[model samples]
Target: MSGERRRVMILAYFYPPLAGGGVHRVLSFTRHLPAHGWDCTVVCAGPDDSWIRDPSLLDRVPAGTEVLRVGGGSGLALLQRLRGARTSATRSSTTIGWLRRAVDWFAFPDSYAGWAARARAVAARRLARGDISVLLSSSPPDSSHLAARSLARRFGLPWVADFRDPWVGLHFRTPPTPWHRARHRAAERAVVAEAAVVLAASHTHERELQALRGRDGRPLARSVVWLPNGYEPANAAASADAESPPRSRDGGAPTASTESRFLLVFTGTLALMDSTFTALEALARFVRARPAARSQLQMVLAGPYESSYAQRVAALGLADLVRLTGSLAHDQARALQRKADVLLLWKPLGVGYRTMVPGKLYEYLDAGRPILALLPSDDEAARMVLDAGGTVVPPGDAAAVERALEAAFGSWLQGGRVPERRPAWLTGHARERLAAELAGTLETIVKGRR
Candidate 1:
């Protein structure tokens, strides 16, 4: 081990095979980290997280990256373990679900409490090796940050806490309760305070942290840094399709002729926060208002929406108009984007959303299709789209959205030029850039400790 690269033990509970936006970020960082003069040892959750699974993303991890896995239980399994229930049936029973949440309310700040014992034990052992230069923690389960705090306190290792999403602020979902909300906020303050540096994925989140105070009454400042998520140019270029002509979705002759049907598309999981259902309403209203525009315009939603939400679409009498294709494979999804006339993004309502910029936004920029965003006027998503030369509409204003759709359709139908894909802002080298920035922060923390 003479004159070798410094080591970083990454504690992220949501790693690959348990796919999502957060995992992608962590995986990309670890995969490209060696080039930045650091070798990584990733300690993350096992494969039991069944919500979103993709083996394709795993290929991004470098060939020899040392991965340490712990049996982090699934949402269901965590509840069962917490409740001390033996069987799935009992765990899912109505009474037990309430009880589990009630208990969770009082215990730890996040679900990562489930993996605390395993991560604490492994992290302490790994950091004691003297060769470990920095302990880095990324959170979604948010448990990873807490684990880093524990190991730093116990082993005297310098640590950096990476907030891919702020723990108590701007989460896509609603808070558990007043108590849980307070606990999460307080715990996040403690976790951030213990870190040598705190890295946030966006500037909006950095501001949110600046608004809060630490237990010792010192306002969190300078230690916080903003690292915006970007599109990886190398990955996009590697996956580029050179020969495919820009064709309409219905399979007509390749058109250099600009006139084509105005097809709007939303491409990701269609959860409660996403606006697929609301967008459908706007489309239906547009069709009702402009009978002649029926053949000229359409909306293709490509992802998994809850069954009840699907039923809502059907019940609203939009069965024939809105086409719902269940979750598409990643390649297929990108292909659909290339064929699209307009990219549609929806921002959820309320303050929690005012700060978040979704991962899909980066990919949308890479897609280069004209974007029609329905977001709050002050929302981060809208701001990013506006910065990238895309159109924005007010949230819940179905009529305004319908009007925007008509204008975009008119342009395409009346022989206006189609937009070109944006230059890749997210490149493989950008990951190297981000890694370098993070590595510098680690060095500062480690040196200060000595």
Candidate 2:
């Protein structure tokens, strides 16, 4: 079998060109997994202009790799249409909210459910092309798992299910009904049970997936790997100077004020699995009590944001202190991640959020920059940050966040921008190593079956 072609068919709904953890995870695997013995082929939903696209990432795909675009991506299009003309429509207030719910009721598994049959067909064709020894599916659009499950059952191919996020208590959106929620739970349980190997993004997620049993009450996947999100050592994380620095919507030289200005950078979405209210309030308090500090403050919300974020900033009287750069290209965002006095992060305050860690945390650690994070103290993410010598304040505790902010600001004022404390062990989170680990897991799985 080793003499036969060693290949993996990956059902990734959003691969390269689509910017996200799912894209980064699979892309890194495809790039480095080959050295560890598995070549790759990816099946993605053709194209949807609605989601953020970074054409830059397409360049990172390995020369001999194959990316197959399957269905016409009606999932995001339908999502855009159902939300009406308002791009900012919330789930509760959308004019077609009921219609959306009605549509979602039939959206068993996930929004990309429509792509399953098409994806299955494409996967069948690829499997027939020869010697694809293993099947892997990455999800958030959990529909990919559904497609892989079908192919696995039909062909008796050993499949690996990678859950970038939890399915049942998913962070993406609220499940429409109890039945829908139950359906997701059942689907997750089934995925864990059937996968030849299951990969969880973190230890907490590994526990969550393993906690579920099969439909017949059997234990889940024979193997589970704690494959946390990681950073690429070769990612060329050099900070690119912005074109004269990002400015506020109202317009002003961001660096003009103060004897000593400090930049707090956050380079990902505020809308998912995180909130900024605690961080925001802490900054507001830090500035109000020391009006002179306002002159030195600048925080960049450097990704997609809502209208209300600006309103909130204005309401807190720190509009001048905050800059929203909207969405940036992947390289641009990575540059921003490195060009900061201190990296700021917020995990949404709740028991649910503790089970997940943001993908950016490792990238931050890899950058060797100091971080000011607002997350639960006992969760896996906090422990990782603490290990790498970054600050973590308990979520929703504005006072604690403010204290951390002030401490970081003091470090910036003192001249080191916080003592460089990133540990040597963080190199373990490098994508190349993780890919090797994944390759070993896949090899073991293939051998066990023999």
C-alpha displacement of 98 in model 1, angstroms? Answer: 8.0
- How well is each residue in 216-299 modelled by candidate 2, as lDDT tens digits? 776677778899888876355344433245544334454443225687888776553335866788889998888888777788
> What is the model-wide C-alpha lDDT for candidate 1?
0.68
Name the candidate that leads on lDDT: 2
Backbone clash tally (model 2): 0
The 10 consecutive residues of candidate 1 with the worst lDDT sum are 86-95
Superposition-based RMSD of candidate 2 using all C-alpha atoms, in angstroms: 3.6
- lDDT of each residue in 248-307, candidate 1, tens digit only: 323355333223566677776654544655677778887788788776655667654445
Query: What lDDT score goes with residue 339 in model 2?
Result: 62
Q: List the residue pairs that clash in candidate 1.
A: 231-426, 232-426, 233-426, 233-427
State every prediction's TM-score relative to the real structure. Answer: 0.83, 0.88
lDDT of 2 at 71: 51
